[model samples]
Target: MSMNDDDAEILAVARAGFLDEAQEMLRQFEQGLLVLEEDPSDSESLNAAFRAAHTIKGTAGMFGCDAVVSFTHEAETLLEALRSGSRQLDEDVVAALLESRDQIELLLGEVQSGEEDPGVKASSEALAARLRALLGATAAAAHAPAATAPSQAPATGALGEPEDGGGDGCWHLSLRFGHEALRNGLDPLAFLRYLATLGETRALRCQTEAIPNLDELDAEACYLGFELRFDSKAKREDIERVFEFALEDSDVQIFEPGTAPAAFEELATRRCGEDPKARAALFQCWHEMGMRFKVRLEVAAVTAAETEAETPQAIPHIERRVGPAEEGKTQKRSDRRSGEGERREGGRDRRAGDETRFVRVRADKLDKLIDLIGELVIAGSGAQMMAHQEASPLLVEATQRVMDLVQETRDGTLALRMVPIGETFGRFQRVVRDVSKQLGKEVDLVVTGGDTELDKSMVDSIADPLMHLVRNSMDHGLETQEGRIAAGKPPMGRLALNAYHDAGAVVIEVSDDGRGLARERILAKAVERGLIAEGQVLPDHEVWQLIFHAGFSTAEQVTDLSGRGVGMDVVKRNIEALRGSIALSSEVGRGTLTQIRLPLTLAMIDGFLTMVGGVNYVLPLSAVAECIDVPAECAAQNERISGTFDLRGEVLPWLDLARFYGISPDTSRRRSVVVVRDGQTRVGLIVDRLMGEHQTVIKPLSAIFQHLKALAGSTILGSGDVALLLDVSGLLNAAIRNGQQIRQTGTAAFAHAVLKS
Candidate 1:
């Protein structure tokens, strides 16, 4: 493919447009396929698939990629057959169509990989053979039609993906074919066909903007710029890659009717330069992004006619918009350009690597990043150790600077992985809809405060527990239609899923309006089952906590809606495993609210480094309350685990840290007890000294010690020794539950032989 400079540039530009359209069309194909699966009878889905396939044919034809156009034409013909009922929409037809879709993707991939024309023909021929057999079963052959196919489509609902996000946040791309494109064996318009895959091109404007007179126009050169709105899945990269090869010589620009970034103006201003080579490169980046480098004079007029079209007042004003003839520029570009308009091929995972561009790294990779960070922490401790051994101030200062740099790098990496929780919440709407239908109930799920983000892994696991909670609410927490009507409430129930940042933790609430829990009944059942005592006095949340006990359900009869005594206990276990807490609160006739609180991140966290005897320990700062000197009377009861310590008349349970870890304290008098609360269960942890806040990188303990319940995880101290991270929630639960369990276990274990009925 020896293209003359002019033909090469022209072909390159046109190829860009072609690919954009192709991408838009393919997006439609994917979505249409999904829609068809959701609603097989939906005439809309059928028409959508037909239209997308049809559009691909027209665009592919323009590029002279006879193979692509020709095969796509056959597919369109078969889809029309299905639409007209000549060929049934059956397993065979859909399976063939799916295979055809895969073939199209393979063809595009072959071209992208620069494989020979031989590979392309083989694939295209295979697809064409499949499609050829499926075509010819059109409307006339079916002989039964209700609505006639419209002669022409009322321009596809504005170009680019089918989202009705108002305002003109849409785009139009124009790619021109330069002269000599055909002579070089390159089709000047192949890229334009590719663009059709992206979305529907609402309008295809063949620009003669630079076309010379008939005699002056070279036959081998391309001189057309197409204006198109590619409507499809929003893949920005494929469109840019079509002309990626023509960065140095061709003219190209894309326009977006969307909010412009603040830096646009400054960038546009600095873009005024005389270096043609640099200008070309810079312009290529700016142009492909569809960023408006200069404010359009027409914007004011257009906006006046319709407020919807107004460009923001802050838009950058380029001295003059870069046009086809203007030379491009060069300079260091920002990280946002990595996949500016490119799509990942073959479903390969992408990560924020060492490259400057923004990318999404997997959690394991980030954990590796955190692991490297831990090694850095250990290395820092080693340096401090070395400095102390040498006892030199200069060594200490140099080590200090390196530690500071490491701290900054760690913070930066962690920040990169932190994502808002809102994205996770959005998928629940579909979940609620499907679950409600399954349970044969009419429920509307309302969500709020979705912008709160968390660690990506936390977001991933939370979905399951949240799903179980929502399902419980639907099946058991909410009332039936007849039950609701009798109570003077709306027949339709309301379930709300909300998430927000609270204190240093993420608070997620799944609440429902229905009949509240039967507290007296649960208590009676617990006593009879021997899970509780005959007469136990507890708060509402404590009673609710009993619901999370294994095989505990108060439902009278079991059905599919729940009550086989599973799920809630599992939800509790999962939340606890993540170092989070779940609590329940309810009003008799109002509703039930299940709230789960989570740590901001499972990675490195801020901790308060403290010591009891000779061992150093890290306490999660999120759980820290005020530390105070234990009074003489309170300190005297260090051996009694159930005794309450009085602080301003508040009776907080006391647990000596020394005794809990099975280590002896240096001194018992004039010691401090740090009081921490888990829900309403307050306990004081007795320690010898309190250390200020330290950056704690958590390291999990081995499984052998995991059941110890007193220790959560471990971390490294500045002295290069390991210290345990306390399980604040677990220790609190054990302090209360274990005390109750002890009294029952002593009496019941030896006495059960004579009590069995």
Candidate 2:
């Protein structure tokens, strides 16, 4: 059927929501599988994994993503077997399930793209076959060992009859759809059709007693209920999951084949409310459907005036007689119902609290909000500037108060985008598991300080780089079990991911306890690649950095994992592209640690403004340790582009911005040194003037200026002039590199001479 524009739009939004929810489910699925692999006895994790897969399948079926539904069903079946204790959990089964998880992800991607890839389809089939084979193996092993057999006995019944008087050994289901179900794009018949795929529908009936008169009918509202008997080997949970997508407002009751009679009475009362006509109608329908029970209806007394009042009268009292055998079962059922009532009430309270506490917002909407906030900050700055220009105390004070509020708003808005990095860190559990297995190594990943928060955009960007580093650590840095044992270390290697906030930046460390970097081999590779001169002496730190050079590898032979020499350099580039820095440290016999430092956020920052010549530049205020007037001696040597300065008995390398970017020096303006720290290193920046602190809304530079050194981005100032934002890490690295070159070549004046020329 063709859809109208509004229907299409609603479907699009729903599809997007389904895709997002599917991704989260996939994460949980993978995490659960990992936990289960570690401890097969963890029933909670097994059930969680099963539910994730089941949810994805059910939701995908609703959206008509047949490929996803089909592929996930195969995995779901295997998970169900594991969950039901019909199949044993083993390494092979876990491996196949993990691979199936990956295939489902690919299937979901195909759904998102609205096209199916032949290759993915073939892969899905192969994985599905493998999962079936695992199930087949379980079946074959059933008779071999009592331990591997199904933990629960099969239901006792012939094909056509249950021993407990449940006709046809079929499950009975009562469904009353919500009023908005049809309007919400749900078709009652669609769920019925899906149920057919799970098993055979023995008998079905649709009740129309709830439908109002044509004059009162709402075309969009659903007023239908259904009763059916389904015969399937699938568990009750699986059948219940078929209706998961509509559970929010629908009333669905699933009865096992042997359910007692009182349950049916309760269902009847709930379905048919107080109206006498509706109650009579439902009773007649159930009787026609051959329900194993009877109802006696007695009319209520009413005055002629009450009957003529035009309002619908209350229903007559309906009573059912219970046999002794049924009465005891009814009492037990009542107690169970009491307990379930309490649990459901608690669940509802918790859900209500959660609904009030958290809101699901579109990412693009948040981005738009952030952009608007940035504009507000700029406008506030302009207003404050104008107020100060007026020189009226009252106006200045009012503007200042507004600016303070603006700053607070900016901070709070940005905090909304801050998410804990643990979510990203959690992804590596599967990576470490798979990569270690592929390499025939034993490695345990330890994650610490995962609650450290950073910008969501940054978290997304950093994942790829972190993945590369993690894989590299497993493939290259961590030695095999035999190698570790030979070195007197534990047979299992340890790879740790740690994150924490350091000086307004997030510091992420990936460290391994295995064979560390070999300095001599790295130096030789550098010389062979002509990246460094032969026989040149350099510090250990400098040698460790050679691995980051493009296409640099010290491995004698290439492997599937790392020896291609293509990852580390790209990792470095990606980190730097985020205006972040990467540093490496290693001990010969110990292990290697690679640390990445990134700004807390990229959209806006508290900046310390400075002027070089006639142009304004901003430095991240968090990086500014202190600002000092250039001493007379250093100020006299203004001709030098780069030099060292003494601060509190320590000498620090300093860069003159005017000369570094080739801008003409403004000798008339007194110079000041702004000391900024990047990681553990500190550098002093020489600028023409300090313009105090400002709220800087960062705007990206044009592609043409992307390669421009030390300029991170551009921002507009209060006076409507563009100010360049400095990349503190990049500037410090440049100054330190220049200092190293000068010391090596005895050309401390080389940079100054180049500027002069």
Clashes of each: 58, 0
Pairing residues by index, what is the TM-score of model 2? 0.89
Q: Counting only residues 3 or more apart in sequence or on different chains, how many pairs clash (N, Cα, C under 3 Å) in candidate 1?
A: 58
TM-score of each: 0.57, 0.89
TM-score of decoy 1? 0.57
Clashing pairs in 2: none
Candidate 1 runs further than 4 Å off: 1-357, 381-402, 533-538, 668-670, 679-681, 740-757
What is the alpha-carbon lDDT for the whole of candidate 1? 0.64
lDDT per residue for candidate 1 within 1-757, as digits (tens), equals 4557766676666666667667667766755665575567887878887777756665555555556665665576577677766666765566567566666666655545556567667877877666656554444233211123322222222222222111234454545555655454445455666555444554455655467899897765777655455443333443454454443233445434332322232233333244333333333344444433443222322334343333334333443333332122211121122222232211113322323465434457777978899778768867876997899999999988898898898888877777877766665655665577677787877889887878877888898899888888888888888888999999999999888876578889999998878899899988978988899876675789899999998888897758888988999999988889998889887999999988878878878777888788777887777788876755665554334546787645566677655678878446777866554455667788887777788888888887786576898876778888887877766655565433432223212211111
lDDT per model vs. reference: 0.64, 0.79
Predicted candidate 2 versus true structure: per-residue lDDT over 1-757, tens digit per residue: 4457778888888889899999999999999999998899999999899889988888888877878888887888787778667888999999999998889899999888888889999999888888888888655343121122222332332222232224445677878887989887787887887676577776788978789999999977999989887766666666767886666556777877656545666656566655544555665565545444433442354344543352222322335455776667655544332324453356557777988998888999999999999999999999999998999999999999999999999999999999999999999999999888889998889999999999999999999999999998898899988888899999999999999999999999999987899988998889989988999987776788788888999888899887978988999999998999998989977999999999999999999999998999999999999998986656766677666656677766677788777789777867788888877777777899999999999999999988777789999987899999999878755644655433432134333322222
After superposition, the stretches of candidate 2 with alpha carbons farther than 4 Å from their true spots are 1-3, 137-166, 183-185, 273-280, 287-320, 323-347, 736-757
